[model samples]
Target: MNKIFFDNWESILRTLVITVLAYIALIAMLHTSGKRTLSKMNAFDFVITIALGSAFATVTLNKDVALADGALVFLLLIGLQYSITWLSVRYKPVKKLITSRPSLLLYKGEVLNDVLKKQRITIEEIYVAARKKGIGSLADIDAMILETAGEITVIANLTDDDSQTLQNVAKK
Candidate 1:
């Protein structure tokens, strides 16, 4: 129907204006928040990012939501995220609560089945990570870690000191 496909000119113009302003506001906010705003997102950061996107959409499309309201929401979320990250850096307990710990998936060419199962990571995922890192065989890998942000880190040809640096993650 025409009603389903197109809104009136006023509605369209309102959307156009709101969209431009909201987009500019989002860019300004991201710039103000620092590099961490776009850094690797963990669970909590992911939620905040999603919320910001949804708020922006609401401000753009919904007639009842004002640009000022949406901007305030964005500011509130960004502030909270920054505060948590700041506190987590100085406090071990806060860090543990806010972020996932790095986990070891493979050690010394051995696929750690127990860790994979516990972490709900599959062998195929490990294989895919290895392939992405250009690893043709497991034997060539010294360690495979599932980082806190859910990215796999492939450590190969590690010297004793290099391996020691990863010992903390060996236990999940």
Candidate 2:
């Protein structure tokens, strides 16, 4: 019970020093990796972000995890992410394999029940996304898509006369 609240002063000091240094190292790594290192472009990018965060916490809090080891792991993950993204850009098949294509949830104010079911999305969720996009009614929506990053995108006030902007979103 006594040990639960009171760790030694030396341990606390060590944690503080390691935490500060790890934070600096992480910032430096992210800067070196470029802006896309932190972008939520797809599920893989999201995983990389989560892994970096986990590594940061481990390096800061786990005394067993050496700072040097943690830094190397961080760099490796960033490098792998960069490499994969580079290859994905040059190769369409790799891009398709690594990232999910955005799915159309609604087209022309009609709820695509089949698409919604396939995407595991509810109509209420679509309404919520529409509401967030400041859409007062379904009739005002042109398209609603579930992006690769699992975000809902709503394009509103579309009509038959308007140019089709959903060419990129995969239709079911």
Candidate 3:
């Protein structure tokens, strides 16, 4: 047992380094991903998160390391995540930088062509989001955003008559 502990020191240290790096990477990634990732946890999101966690675990603790090394990595990741969470809450600039706010998908009764191109999203995708929200035509949509995590958000500027029609469809 004692011999085993000494034999695996390098493996243990490597795992520590890898795990710290991985945790920081994840924190930065999630922070930049925006609130939609947290608020909108669908099936795809769940599966992807699980798969990523498994991969990160493997990268942090290869079989060369003992069980203790893996455990230490896990603990360090948790600690780093906690600290980052606290920091994000305490600092406004950090929160703004980390959490991307919603951008107008459409504004002033027009599809913002520049914004769509900036996101590298196709018009069809925005149209699809409008359709999901019961809009039939792009002409009716005023603004829309392809969220940071690839969720499409639609904004419609409707006249009183149009609002009544949409409200009817939305109720159904």
Candidate 4:
């Protein structure tokens, strides 16, 4: 009976350690990537994330690295992310260096030809976004800006749903 009880206890402890280590590893990996990295996962990001998930899960499930060792590495990564975030926030130059500014897509309903060429955006995309709001012509737009996030913002001449949204931002 004593042997059986000890075996059960050992199994439970091992399971608990694996669970904790798995979570810590995943969280640490995500935290280290920064907010910008998660904005959009391209093909490269999808492949890397899958590969890493497999390796980390195996390391924890197989008990290759001791629970403490995995946890330590995870915590160290988290700490490094925290340090970088703090430094980036405190330093203006660093903040500007990392954060991208919004791109001016159009001014007074006229597309900035130079910006369109620089951003590699085709005229077709501009027409599609305008058409989404029942706008057949770009002349109806006052200003349109594209955020660094690749999101399009259309400032229309009238208060449609799209214009209402932009007006809400101003009202606030």
Candidate 5:
């Protein structure tokens, strides 16, 4: 019980040194891995971000995990992320497997109820998104999209041009 509150000066010093080195290694690895390593673009990216944090915490608090081991773990994760992202960019199947397609929640002033239910989104949430976009009326909303990043994008019904922006969006 006493050890829980105060381990010793050596342990404290070890933790301090390890923490600083681990932090520097993490930052350097992240910088080397590029922006995609820390992106919240999709669920896979989110998972990687969470895993990195967990590894960092383990390195910081767990004496069993050496600084070198933590650095290696960071490298492994970042390298995997980089490789997967690279492959995903070149291969359609890989991209499809790792990422989700955006869903159209509203179209031409009509609410896609089935999509809303399937996506576990409520009409009230859509309304709030529209309001955030400064939309005064539902009739003014041309489309509402549930993006892969879990963001609600409200499009105004001001244009008549047949834009290809919704070409890849899932209508159902």
Candidate 6:
């Protein structure tokens, strides 16, 4: 019963030391891996972020797992992310495989029911996004895009410029 509350001074000191060192190693590796390592740009990136957090926690709390082993795991995961992202940037097939295309939910003030249904998005969510963007009414919104990062981008009906930015977004 006592062990449940207090293990020992040595164990506590080891945990503290390991936590600081592991954290420093993680920060260093994240910096070396580049900005993409920390970006939540797509689902794959999100998974890597979650895995990193899980690994950090395990390493901090599990004394059986050595600090060197934890650092190696961090390095491996970051290296894999870097390689995948590097390939994705240079290859069209890799990019398509790893990420989803942005989708157009509303176009020309018309709600695309098919797209909304396919994406499982509600009309109320669209209204909330539009209102957050300072839109007064649905008619004032020219386009509402569901970005790859799962964010709703509300474009106002007032843009006079050509929509070159939306060329790649799936409109269905």
Give the candidate number with the greatest lDDT: 6
Tell me, by TM-score, which candidate is best: 5
Q: Which residue pairs overlap in candidate 6's backbone?
A: none
Q: How many angstroms is residue 19 displaced in model 2 relative to the true structure, after the best TM-score fit?
A: 0.7
Worst 10 residues of 1 by lDDT: 161-170
TM-score of each: 0.93, 0.90, 0.54, 0.53, 0.95, 0.94
Candidate 3 residues 99-163, lDDT tens each?
Answer: 55545556545677777676677778777788799988777776565554568767676555454
lDDT of 6 by residue, 1-172 (tens): 8699899999999999999999999999999999888776689998888899999999999999999999999999999999999999999999999999999999878899999999999999999999899887888888899999999999886356358878899988
lDDT (Cα, tens digit) per residue for candidate 5, span 88-162: 999999999999999999888889999999999998999899889988787788889999999998888636646
Query: In what order do the candidates fall by TM-score, top score first?
Result: 5, 6, 1, 2, 3, 4
Ranking by lDDT: 6, 5, 1, 2, 4, 3
Model 5: what TM-score? Answer: 0.95
Model 5 residue 126 CA deviation in Å: 0.5
Tell me how many clashing residue pairs each candidate has: 0, 0, 6, 0, 0, 0
Cα deviation of 23 in candidate 1 (Å)?
Answer: 0.8
Candidate achieving higher lDDT, 2 or 6:
6
C-alpha-based local distance difference test score of model 2: 0.87
Compared with the true structure, model 6 gives a TM-score of 0.94
Tens-digit lDDT string for candidate 4 (34-123): 774344543333444565565566556664576666556555544554465467679977656554556667766788888887767888
The positional error of residue 90 in candidate 2, measured at the CA in angstroms, is: 1.2
Which structure is stronger by TM-score: 5 or 6? 5
Q: How much lDDT does candidate 3 score?
A: 0.61
Stretches of candidate 3 above 4 Å error? 1-61, 157-172
Which scores higher on TM-score, 2 or 3?
2
Off by over 4 Å in 6: 158-162
